[model samples]
Target: MARAGAVNYLFGTRFYKMAYVEFGNPAAPAVVCVHGLTRNGRDFDALAEALSDRFHVICPDLPGRGKSDWLQDGLAYQPPTYVVALAHLLAQLNKPVSWVGTSLGGICGMMIAAAQNTPIKKLVLNDIGPYIPSASLQRIRDYMLEAPERFGSMADLTQHLREVHAPFGLLSDAEWAHLARFSARQVLDPTGSGKRIAMHYDPKIIDPMRAAVPLDVDMWPVWEMIHAPRLVIRGAESDLLLCETYERMLKEGAEGYVVADAGHAPALMDYESQARIKAFLLEG
Candidate 1:
């Protein structure tokens, strides 16, 4: 059976929605898994399956992505907005929650978890941390700042993924097809040309003071505020999460691990990555 679910909630005067997948008993210890930029809750499917029996896992699609409703104003697609929405979601659950966030989601978790007396009991940052490299951020923005482009067929989409997400490494043709279908949603135009989802987020979400210049934001204060037990996973070849950041985490006494043959992020499907995360989350 499909383990997915969704709930609607309001932010400010605007109404929005988010989708989640639930697993295990409601009364059990809870874990929240969030997806990276341009991805949805569905990205956690494999990892959720592995943890479902042991914990109450809920993976939510963030606003402007996946099944979540797009804001009438795309400028609202910032980390602070997501943190507020998630605070409401956790209040709905009415329990202390732990978090495992990939990429953008991880950044949100860090901000929330660092707050004094925050509800997040433990944190697992998958392929993200404070002090994101400018080069990696620019690469992500380059893709997000563009309007959804159409492809002739699944093969065309796969080629796009290969060039853009080469860090994800080689997948079989079938795997590429599976990802392409989920990442795209049909547009309502008369001709029915398909469009990439998350089309609602404004391309200028992060406008530089001048065009073509990189934007930089420092997050060391937030990183230092983390109080709960934390685990950070970095893919060995990742452009986003660097070795230096991982080493600094180790120096700060946070648990750290690296995955092989992966870049930017490693899907929890990797055996070593799963074991490292599972062990951290299960620790008493």
Candidate 2:
């Protein structure tokens, strides 16, 4: 195992905290892994552990979704908010960083990298891009829009996770348990709220984004602006990243990988997915 630590830093007047977990020597070149919407830093645990030997890995729980503090307003959960937070994070790190971002995280990467100057030196966009389908966006909003309610036990939460994240596909009970544990934080009482607190994220974050979808905002100009090496990974069954979009990416000279048995996103947990990501990140 690589040496690791948790570092928290402020983002704005709001005092958002990002939990940074390192998996290798501090001196090693760094790769930062950002999780999807509704996910936290722990989502990268397995992947970071696997790469610890060769790279210093930093995984941050985006505000409102993990150990990080939730925004006072859910509307603050938008991409512009995240992009600013990321810029702050980069300034603190004080170095060029490689990025591995899934879904929402990937979009943040796209926006940042498309700019005239970006902190990222290389990027791995996992199951996301300029174009996202309305069906998938609607599916995600439907789940995110739900209000939190009491569940009798962890078992109930686990079942809910499985049902809502059915796109993640069948996993063992143990896997579901792991997902449940990291997803919800105690909200009940001092001894700990047996009642789960849905990590505070405003579902309204996706509203302005709705107009940008169906065919997706013309992020193509930004795609052309990125100078860093880039690799895009799409789940073969992903509804969000279309085959046509992937082809457009290829025409733009971007490299890509397709993962089987995944949808919307690839966790990079499976060996094949891991191999693809590792190779891309390690590329000269």
Cα lDDT listed for each candidate: 0.75, 0.74
Candidate 1's error at 13, in angstroms?
1.3
Q: Tens digit of lDDT per residue, candidate 2, span 1-284?
A: 53434445455565666655668765777888888887776777778877777788888777666666566665567778777767777777778788999998888888888776677989999888777767777777667657355555677777887777766644667767777787765566444556655443334445544445433445677777888888999888888888999888878877999887777777677667777778887889
The TM-score between candidate 2 and the true structure equals 0.87
Worst 10 residues of 1 by lDDT: 195-204
What is the clash count for each candidate, in the order shown? 1, 2
Compared with the true structure, what per-residue lDDT tens digits does model 1 show for residues 7-44?
A: 77778886677777787777888889988876777667
Candidate 1 lDDT (Cα, 0 to 1): 0.75
Q: Give candidate 1's error at residue 153 in angstroms.
A: 2.5
Runs in model 1 lying further than 4 Å from the true structure: 146-148, 170-174, 189-213
Task: Give all candidate RMSDs, comma-separated.
Answer: 2.8, 3.3
